[model samples]
Target: MGCATGIVKYLVFIANLLFALAGLALVIIGILIKFNVSDATRVLPSDFGLAPILCIIIGAIVFITAFLGCCGAVRESTCMLTTYAIILLTIFIVQVAIGVYAFLQIKDQNSFYSALKTNMEKTFDQMDRNPEANETMHVIERVLKCCGVTGPEDYQTPKVPLSCCRNIEVQCPSPNNDVNSDGCAIKLQGEIEKNSKIIGGVAIGIAVIEVLGAIVALCLASSIRNSYRRHTYA
Candidate 1:
C-alpha cells in the first residue's frame, strides 16, 4: 500500500508540473497570437477578436489550479486533492463546450466565406473615405499578398492600390503585372482555416491532459482517505 501510494503521489506531482508548463505555454501562445493577428482582427467578427483574451484567462486559471494540485499532492491532503479534481473536471467541461461552440460557428463554410467577403467589400469601398479603413486595407493587402476583395479589377481605376504591388518599395506599373493576383477574401479564408486546425489540435490535446489529471487526482484523494480511515481504525 505504501509503495502504491508513493507512486500515485509522484505521478500527481509530475502531472501538476506538466499542467503548470502547459498553462504558461498557453499564456505565451495567446499573447503571440493576439499581436500576430491584430491586423486581421479588424476585419474578422468581434467574437473572434476575443480568442486570445480567453486563452490568457484560461491559462491563468489552469496555472493556479495546477499550483493547488501540486500542493495537495505533496501534502497528501484529501480535501485539497478533491478540490483540485473538481476544478479539473470543471475546466474540462468548459473547454469541451467552447470547442463545440467554435466548431459549430465554423461548420458552415459557405456562410462564413460570404460574411468575410461582405466585410471585405465594405472595408474596401470605405477605403477612400475612411483613413482607418484605408490603412487597414493596405496592411491586409500587403501582409496577405492579396488585392481587392475579388481582384485588382474590383478597383474603379486601372491602377491598383500600392499595397497590391508585390514590392511596396518599387513603383506600381500601369499594366499591374507586378501585383498579387489572389483575392483578400480567399487568402483570409485560407489563413483562418489553417489556424483553426492548429487551434483545434491544441484544444484536443489539452482536454486529454485535463481528463487524465483529474482522474489521477481523484484516485490519489481516494487512496489518502482510505489510508486515513485504516490508520484510525487500526
Candidate 2:
C-alpha cells in the first residue's frame, strides 16, 4: 500500500500543481477584467444574467484555492491534497457551464432589446404619473447624458442616460439595475456585461484549475523530495 499511496500522492500532487497554475492565471485575468469594468467599459451583455458580484466571488475563489494548494503542499498528506485539487477542477467545469448559459441567454439580441424597451416604458409611465416622480425622469436623462446614449436600443446615439449616474466609486452602474438608469442605459447595459463576466471569469476559472493540477503533479514527481525537509525544514 506504500507504493499505491505514493502513486496516489504523486497523482494528487500533479493535479494540485495544475490547479494552482490555472488558479493564478484566472486570478490575473479576473483582476484585469474587473479593472476594465471599473473603468465603465461595458464588456458583457446585460442579459447574460451573471452579476459582477458573482464575478468577484469567482475571482476570490481562485485566490482562495491558492492558499488551499499551498496548505496541501506543506501538509504532505495526499488525501487532504487531492481534496483541494478536486474542488479546483470542479469549479472550472462549473464556470464553463456558466459561459454556455450566458451565451444562450443573450443570443437573441432582439428579445433582450424588447425586454429593455418594455422595462423603460414601464419606468417612464410611473415617472409621468407622479409630480414627485419628475426627478426620476431627469435622473434617467442624466444617465443618458453620461453614457452618451439615447433610447433603449440607441447604442449609436451620442447621449448617455442620466439614470446611470451613481455615487458608487466602483463600476459606475451596479450590476443590479435598481441603482442606475431607467431605460436607455439599462437597456444597452447588459450587452457588455456578459463578456465582462466570462472573459476574465472563465479565463481565470480555467487557469486556476490548470495550475493547481500541475502543482499537484509536480509534488508527486518529487515524492521524497521533502521527506527529510518536512521535519528539518519545519
Tens digits of per-residue lDDT for model 1, 13-87: 988888888888889889998887665566776677797998889889988899899999999998999999899
Look at candidate 2 and tell me the lDDT of residue 150.
34
Candidate 2, lDDT over the whole model: 0.52
What would the TM-score be for candidate 2 when compared with the true structure? Answer: 0.47
Q: After superposition, how far is residue 217 of candidate 1 from its true place, in Å?
A: 0.7
Q: Each candidate: what lDDT?
A: 0.86, 0.52
Candidate with top TM-score is 1
Q: What value does the lDDT take at residue 127 in candidate 1?
A: 85
lDDT of 2 at 61: 75
Per-prediction TM-score to the true structure, in the order listed: 0.85, 0.47
